[model samples]
Target: MHIMEGFLPSPWWQVWFLVSLPFIIIGLYQINKLVQEKREALPLLAVAGAFVFVLSSLKLPSFNGSCSHPTGTGLGAVLFGPCIAAVLGLIVLVFQAVFLAHGGITTLGANVFSMGIAGPAVAYLIYKVGTRAGANTYATVFVAAALADLATYVVTSVQLALAFPGTAGFLGAFSAFAAIFAVTQVPLAIIEGAVIMLVFKYIVQLKPEILTRLNLLSESTIKKLQEAAA
Candidate 1:
């Protein structure tokens, strides 16, 4: 649900833009810190960003004019952490805004804050919490991805409701969009989660070395991997 440039009233949009500027700046600073700390993952981040761009570009048929696309933030956050995912998302959204016109320039700040920042952040939190609770990797990935996708829609709905208060109150708008979007998003989330889990499983099998370098697959998991490989 990308908000067009002039969707909101001029005065309100201007105020929202001004309020969102600090978040953009903070996001950029966090991105810079991530780059400095995780230089090795830069190439991976680029690759992941490219993947997200391509994946999001492919629109699946959905309700009315609204279409759904895969949000690759969950996989990225799980693998590289949310800081990098947030930066990757920002880059992807910016490119899409300029080239594809999927989202708008004036609404870029709100878009980035909602889809890029909130999605990955919530996904990472869910994944972490699930893992801590002794959930299986696949389950954690699935739940986190689903929640992340839902969270983005919720955030987008809120933005839209704020922009067009005549439609409904914030909660009402949020619930309406969530219900509409969930039809497409829920299935997509399941598909994405399965794909991510399978891909992770294969990568661990083919190049366990990469997992070790990333400090992802634990020693116990490595043992299980070797057993499975055998």
Candidate 2:
């Protein structure tokens, strides 16, 4: 969910900007390193950024000053780690804020923090844990993507609740925002998860070498996925 442009009042927006700055800085560094180390990944990185832009632009009216949509950060996180994904997300958000009017420049920091930093971080962690646990590759992808979408909304809710606690206080406000987001976000998460799973499968089938270079999958697992696709 994107908290609309300028919806957040004075200090809250500034706070979020400060909080999100470090991640963005680190993400930029990571991206430069990636570009230098693996020029072959440039095209795939573009695809990931486009995926985030397109999916997140599909906004549906939700709570006041906010909207719900699929956050496509998980695929990038799974493909290139969370820091690099954050850079991709930041670029997408900037474009959305400028031309698309989906989000606002004032609240860009908050949106990036939730969708880019928090969501991708959680997704990357989940993917790592799932793979380490010997879970099915596609299944893990689904879970990571789904949970990443949900995580974005959750962080958005937190940001909203913090900005406007009202009489119900922070916890109460968070519960209210989260409840509203869950109605739309849950379904979107499931659909995004399925879509990302399919995309990952395709990548596994067609570009297993890339996965091997990235250490995303073991040779044995890539072989199995390739065979399954065949």
Candidate 3:
């Protein structure tokens, strides 16, 4: 999913970077505000970021010899909120670019917007909506994570198509990539959803207090447990 340097023409790539700069700055500022408000969550965010970085480097075989890995943005967003996750994602991309050359510098802005911003934002929204509709914690996390992964790929496909508009314009190229990518991504989404559920289940069991502090455990459930303990 990471776009390579020189994959697209220089002029268009430069335009993308310039256009995405403001949004990146805004996202970073939001992350700073979140850190100020919830200093305790900073360590957790770092841990999540590291986890994502490592996971992202691991490439699983996919169709046509292409490979993919878990973005882990959904998990981060659900835990620390979308803004923080977006910032963390930028950090992850920077590291990957310098060390692994997974994504290029020229296309960093586009990559961040697609994989970092869009994934976490979509996941957080879905989680919030699902929770508000009375979905269970596991269900909310799983569905949100899955949808977030799907959204990331969708955005990436669109970016690729736009970057390489030829005889086929944006929509035509997008449709071609989307059709191929979606097949692999759909199953990837399900795997991510299950992984999130499993990780969350263990986290709740091992350190229930953290869940309360994070506001992830439902208030109603917490109250019932407190009453039972008393």
Number of the top TM-score candidate: 2
Which lDDT value does model 3 have at 162? 81
lDDT of 1 by residue, 102-161 (tens): 787777767776777778888889877886887776667777877787777777777776
- Alpha carbon deviation, residue 178, candidate 3 (Å): 0.7
lDDT of 3 by residue, 1-230 (tens): 77776776767677767756775687678767777987865677778889989978886445545467878877878877776777788889988999998888878877887888888999999888987887767778888888888998898888888877668888899999999889878887877778777777776655677778778766676555455445
Each model's backbone clash number = 0, 0, 0
Order the candidate numbers by TM-score, best to worst: 2, 3, 1
Worst 10 residues of 1 by lDDT: 59-68
Off by over 4 Å in 3: 34-41, 59-66, 222-230
* Per-model C-alpha RMSD: 3.3, 3.3, 3.5
Name the candidate, 2 or 3, with the larger TM-score value. Answer: 2
For residues 34-96, write the lDDT of model 2, one tens digit per residue: 789888668878987997788777763444434556788887888888888888988999988
